[model samples]
Target: MAAGGSRPEPFVVSSVEKVHRVMSWLKEIFGSQSLPPFEKNSETFDLLYTLAEYSEERERDASVLIEDMKERAAKYDAEAEYLQSILTETFDLSPSVLSEEGSAHLKTLVDTAMILDTKDTSLASLFSAISDRSLELLAAETKNKELELNLLEVRNKLTATLALENQLRMDLKKAEKDLEVEEAKAHFRLQNLQFLKHKSEDISIRIKSAEEKLIAIGLQESLMHEPLMKLSQKLAEVQEETVQVKKKLECYFNLPTSLPLARVKIEEAKRELNALEEKVSMRIEEMTDDFLELERL
Candidate 1:
């Protein structure tokens, strides 16, 4: 079973070999210690195969980039040699014999020619003037950026101010509505106060007229209230006392009619007493006979 397990199918063996090659390549790129143990399965083999193909593609791209850089370097080297020859032949000075100041001046002139897209070193003065214009343009651009920033800040502040103004307007409207409601309530209350005042004045007028009429009839004002009230209280007290006296008189008048009923009740009580006395004598004679029989025994 171990031998059979160790041996895999032909396709699996081929896939395993391919995965091993990919693993070796990966180890070269990212050291063996960085990679995990290779898994022997169809899925793992497929993944390793795909990774190998992708790595080859990236390697090809890197080779092309390296070639391009090498070409550029070679071209730059040739240009440098040509420039050195020109300096040695035309100026009778090798690059090694040129002074630091002259070298710096030549480099600046070359840089300026490159910037202006021209090969004319004679236009150095024009390049200087153009450089000044570029400096001014850069300064203008920087100032423009600052102005844009300030404008943005101002716009943000204006937006906030507008929002606050809108909120204040809404609050003002709400306050106005509340004020109107309060004013309406106050007006209603004032009208009610005025109505009450008029009603009280009318009542006062009616009371004054009634008092005048009473005076014209020769009746004293004090007699209309306090004296009448006192008379009414006295009359109620006299009526209560009369009712008590009448009750006592009625009880005395009913006594003659109740006497015959009282005498008949007394006669019925005497007859009940005589019947009780005869029943007691009969119970005593029966008890004496029972006692004499017991003595004879």
Candidate 2:
């Protein structure tokens, strides 16, 4: 203590003192409410104390502002009462004294003032200008609405027309496709008809050539069909009968004595020969009738 005779600071704040000061500030701000627990360190105490000081300063400023506002409000109220008394005594202006029309006009003026964003309703010229401007604005709005409706209708019609155009385009495409298919079918049928016509002409030429050849051989063209067929069948049957007769003659020549059995077999053969002769005569008669009919034709 005697080396340099330096003295320690007299009003040094401990962490506990700072914490107490913070608690007192909190009580003043919050009406003595229980404070929440917090860490009791030097840093914590210092921070809390700084915050408490700031809050106390703000509270003081707010209280001063409130007092000034109350004084102004009291002054304004007194002025309003004085003005009301003057209005009643000098102009006789009151709810009972004002006519309904005057009240309505006053309300209109007040509303006009509000719309114009001003408190001055003493300018008659300003109210007239505002009323004219409002009328113009209303007319403009109505015209704009009508134009919008017309535009909407035009758009709807355009949409419908576009849709119809698309449908027609599709139908046209389909029709073109159908026409192409039909044209192809017609072309194919034309080709088939031409081929058939050519084939028929070739067959006719062949038939004509065949008829010419038959005429050169001195045969009637009519003999080439039914009559020729009948003659060929009859010639075949005669050849078969001749072969059977040769076979019977050979059997008769090769017979060993057995005359009685040979006679019985010969009788059966004779009956078969008679039957074949009768059939041949009938065929000849039929051929003669056919030849006569052909001559007549």
Best by lDDT: 2
Whole-model lDDT for model 1 versus the true structure?
0.73
Cα lDDT, model 1, residue 234: 61
User: What are the Cα lDDT values of the candidates?
Assistant: 0.73, 0.79
Q: Mark the 10 consecutive residues where model 2 has the least summed lDDT.
A: 113-122
Over 4 Å off, model 1: 1-22, 37-52, 109-297
User: How many residue pairs clash in all the candidates, one count each?
Assistant: 0, 0
Query: lDDT tens string, model 1, 52-160?
Result: 8798899999999999979976966787788788878898888578789988987887786666654345556567768877998999999999999999999999999
Candidate with best TM-score: 1
> What TM-score would every model get versus the actual structure?
0.39, 0.35
